[model samples]
Target: MKWLKFKILILIILMLQVEAKADGIYFGGGFYSLSAEVGNKSTSLSNPSAYSLSYTKSFFPQISFEIGYSFLFESLIGGDMSYGPQIGVRYYHYGTSTNSTASLEGLSIHEVKSYNPYLSAGFSQKEFQSIKSSYSGFYLGGGVEMGWKKNLSLFSDFKYSQLSGPVQGKANELTIIVGIIYHDF
Candidate 1:
């Protein structure tokens, strides 16, 4: 009986410790622009607008995994619209004197203001006429998140991707994104 009680006490203590840690799920949406070049020809597509939705799971205060989907209103290659899913891991770094507290829905929350830099690799497929082309590549970028409230923030980032596939030569792309994030603690 004493051993069972001791085990129960240990479990309760561990739960309390976990509750004190900062870990949560986050959802975000934003707008993006993509520019691409294939071979010696740059796509004539202008500043096309795209939308993205993402979900992130933070296992630690500074590290998280994110998965998201993006849909372009117009194709960078010109004929039809394109869309794809992406997954990546991100790391967050806080500034020395950046900390704040706010009340959201009557709950007090804490956050840090800083920059987050990340590297990601993904694959996407676009169809032109009846021909389907696939692209796979990696991108590196960094961004800043400014906390608006305890659970909400605004952010922006830029990424450069180098892709190769059935194209005449390597296709290079530059993307810019601006968005808002909501955290569920």
Candidate 2:
């Protein structure tokens, strides 16, 4: 019947729309904690808790790529402070990751599902007022992402960054974020 055929066509179109939505640019904001270490100083350098904004695009059904920057500042001794940015990447699948930390050297096996579990590794640095001090290192951690509604979802990750440069120290970074994704319905 004509009605039956029309319904089929509409269903197909809707499916395509959802498929497209599954992969696109996602942007949102939330809180970020910067692990303070790696700089030249005896006192611990802590960047003031701050906000972060990030962008992600799904290259495939289960695989998505993301990059973002955060700002932080903390007071040390008399009239001294530090702050800077962090960048990262991920490669994930249904509740599992082939390798969350992808780089120019390791790049392969994109996503193949709707749900993605991921790991992140990145670096951040800041300048010290006293000795041109710098804190820079890499973070290693994992996260899971779920779609709660159309173009919106919840995201969270746990990571550890090791600091080594002027002074030696270690820090733990944890983040919980809720966001309105532009894609991934």
- Provide TM-scores for the models: 0.61, 0.54
Model 1, span 1-185: residue lDDT tens: 99766666665554433323233333333444444566676653434465567766666656666677665555443446556666766676532112344442344445455544444444433322223566656666656655565556666655555656576545555556677766544
The CA lDDT at 184 in model 2 is 40
Best by lDDT: 1
Ten-residue stretch with the least lDDT total in model 2: 96-105
The alpha-carbon lDDT assigned to residue 103 of candidate 2 equals 18
lDDT of 2 by residue, 1-185 (tens): 99766666665554433433444343333344544444453344333343445666556655555566543334312344344556666666442222121112232212223445676666655444455666667767666666555444555555555655554554444444444444542
After TM-score superposition, the amount by which residue 53's alpha carbon in candidate 2 deviates from its true location, in angstroms, is 1.1
The per-prediction CA RMSD against the true structure, in angstroms, equals: 8.5, 9.8
Q: Which ranges of candidate 1 are over 4 A from the true structure?
A: 1-44, 75-79, 95-109, 112-131, 167-169
- What is each predicted model's overall lDDT from 0 to 1? 0.53, 0.49
lDDT of 2: 0.49
**Candidate 1: worst-modelled 10 consecutive residues by lDDT:** 95-104
